[model samples]
Target: MTLSFFQKFWSVLANDIMAVISSFFHLGQLLTAINHTFISLIPKIPNPSLVSHYRPISLCNTLYKQILDNVMIAHDYLHFLNGKHKGNNRLMAIKLDMSKAYDKIE
Candidate 1:
């Protein structure tokens, strides 16, 4: 096995991530530092010109991502938002959590 495989299988990383995720549920808290993500824009094809031709992806630490994914799965937010509505009019819903919005300002 490679070093990375050994590290992942034997290290305390899994425990640490579970602890963080547990705190998120029991205490309703998340680390502010982990919320910051680096967004990178990659071109879909060579010699692309338009903004739509680029795909944007968020990059974060693997541990942070795993915790976030767990939380999302528990909440099932995407499943609710993606459900079809039977109507001629468009249905829309917006969720805004501004608990620490001001802290994001420079």
Candidate 2:
């Protein structure tokens, strides 16, 4: 079913899920499945040899996707503002992937 359908018909279920997510976050608990991901390498050229010739992408799960959707809204607004800036003003937005950094911390 579409997102709109879910929101219209299963609003309570949606709200409950959000509440659960909020509670889990407040308690500093995260599900292992949310951290689990599969990395796939796709070749950029037909005859690829070195790792640089391929691009590695992670196939993330639903909860991660939901988090990204919210984050991307902010990014979208930053992109729009950067595009609309006039005169000598320059707007810069930076995106950093800190997941690997988090994994290394004890």
Candidate 3:
């Protein structure tokens, strides 16, 4: 049976929608299966292996230094806010004006 143009179009659209819905359902089932598998495996495993094996001592030291510096800066800012640098009234009145707010003249 030959389908009219509109009928063919509707049929194609319906098929595409069904395909998307089926794939979405399949994805949900896949996620559920994965969760179940992980849950079942957790208790049976004696030792869990760490997948991320990159451990650099020098990198760690650098990160520690950066964290320390940031903490010190934050502490200094807190101290300043709490009247530690209240005598520097000139620094407080310094106005910073953005040249181009949002317009780029160039």
Candidate 4:
């Protein structure tokens, strides 16, 4: 039995949604880790000058890393789906022509 176009589309959409949700959960864990690390550093830093400058930089680095990691994971997921479907030889062709299809009279 073969699935119809709508079926295939829905299946792919579900997979994509699951991937995104998983990514979000991973990001949340990463944020928690970063927060914990920052909290741990708070007591060690005796000088206010050092804490003020370094905290922002550390948070920025953590954010940048998470964004980059999520993007790469999404890219890989897309590539994996593309490769999975590449083996199936399928062609979809559509042609639409609208000539004198609408008329208005006043």
* TM-score of each model, paired residue for residue: 0.39, 0.41, 0.20, 0.24
What is the Å distance of residue 15 in model 2 from its true position? 12
Give me the candidate number with maximum TM-score: 2
Where does candidate 3 have its weakest 10-residue lDDT segment? 34-43
Question: What is the lDDT of every predicted structure here?
Answer: 0.65, 0.70, 0.43, 0.46
lDDT of 3 by residue, 54-103 (tens): 22211122212344576698677666766745555523332344454432
Model 4 residue 104 distance off true place after TM-score fit, in angstroms: 48
Candidate 2's TM-score reads: 0.41
For residues 1-106, write the lDDT of model 1, one tens digit per residue.
Answer: 2336536685656787678879999999998876777877878899989999888765665555565566677468656656745676555656666545422211
Clashing pairs in 4: none
Model 4 CA deviation exceeding 4 Å by range: 1-65, 86-106
Tens digit per residue, CA lDDT, model 4, 62-83? 3234545866986876666666
Among residues 3 or more apart in sequence or in different chains, the pairs in candidate 2 whose N, CA or C atoms overlap within 3 Å are none
Taking every candidate in turn, the Cα RMSD to the unseen true structure, in Å, is 11.5, 10.1, 22.3, 24.0
Better of 2 and 4 by lDDT: 2
Q: What is the lDDT of residue 48 in candidate 1?
A: 89
**Candidate 2 deviates by what RMSD?**
10.1
Ranking by lDDT: 2, 1, 4, 3
Displacement of residue 105 (Cα, Å) in model 1 is 30
